[model samples]
Target chain A: DTAVSQTPKYLVTQMGNDKSIKCEQNLGHDTMYWYKQDSKKFLKIMFSYNNKELIINETVPNRFSPKSPDKAHLNLHINSLELGDSAVYFCASSPQGHYGYTFGSGTRLTVV
Target chain B: SQQGEEDPQALSIQEGENATMNCSYKTSINNLQWYRQNSGRGLVHLILIRSNEREKHSGRLRVTLDTSKKSSSLLITASRAADTASYFCATERQGAQKLVFGQGTRLTINP
Candidate 1:
């Protein structure tokens, strides 16, 4: 059973376009997070939601927004995607704020 | 700006040998976690040690935490060629929901 899964394993789009990545976690975790891993392999947290409540939001661009319609799902939407938006996005979930996270395979986004 | 700093950025050893990696963090944390990541994949949680705990072990992995020194180490015994991967330490800051990861220590185990 896949604990965390993301749709559209790969995404390729042009600038000014919009794309969304969907994530689902059946681990029954209350907290879910989005992280971006750059070419340098530096992974940074972008956003985190707990029990469907937004908790942490790093200094992410306004073009990127995270929405959690329910506790089991969290989706990330990028508006007017730019070249800098190209990176691997990973979805992670934890039982609480301080537990080990179960991460998804990742969504490789390419913006041209 | 980096919270976790792993030493010896990379290491190479023969199969059956033990591999060790160290991680040092800047701030106080509720717990520290170790994760393994292959070349271009997602991270897999290995183990987690809370501030109150000193050591924890799982399978062939052993972790030790020293809160006073703000450091942690992961030791993998009986390494195999398949153990060649990057290991990272993630620190969950006290009261912070997000985890800060280290710059990873890449281990290359030779058969």
Candidate 2:
């Protein structure tokens, strides 16, 4: 079984359009996160939630918002997407205080 | 901002050869982890080394950590073509729960 799963493996939308990506983890982890991998292959953490509570919110733009309905699901909603939003987004989860994370297959977003 | 930076953004080697990747971090860490990502796939956890430990081995993978230098290295022995993937090093801070990742190193294993 896939431990971490993400919906919409690829997404293409026009500028100013809004989109949402869904992520779920079956590993029973307490913490989940969203990371963006740019063209340079730099993966940066955007947000993190533990037990459905926001814990870390990097200096990300206001257009990007993450919502966690429960400890098992974390979703990202992008408002008015821009060309700069084109990148691979990864969802990850880990047990609290654990060392490693289980990442889901990334969602490649393209804003035209 | 990312606290870890990987050296040699890309590497190429023949099959059965060894591949080495290095990562340097800025602050004290509780542990360091190595992850592998194939083309169009998610990151897979490979191995981890604690701050107190100096070296660790898992099958063909060897990891070394130097707390004084705030650096770590991952060595893959007898690498196969299937081992061709991007490698990233992530560090968990001493007290923080989030991990700071480095720009990955792309490794290409030529058959």
In lDDT terms, which candidate is top? 2
Worst 10 residues of 1 chain A by lDDT: A96-105
TM-score per candidate, chains pooled: 0.97, 0.98
Off by over 4 Å in 1: none
**Model 2 over residues A1-112: C-alpha lDDT tens digits?**
9599999999999999999999999999999999999988889999999999999999999999999999999999999999999999999999977668999999999999
lDDT against the true structure, per candidate, is 0.93, 0.94
Per-model C-alpha RMSD: 1.1, 0.9
lDDT for position A70 in model 2: 92
Q: Which lDDT tens digits does candidate 1 get at residues A9-78?
A: 9999999999999999998999999999888777899999999999999989999999999999999999
Q: Which pairs of residues clash in candidate 1, taking residues 3 or more apart in a chain or in different chains?
A: none
CA error at residue B85 for candidate 2, angstroms: 0.6
Return the top candidate by TM-score. 2
DockQ of 1: 0.79
Q: State the displacement of the C-alpha of residue A64, model 1, in Å, after optimal TM-score superposition.
A: 0.4
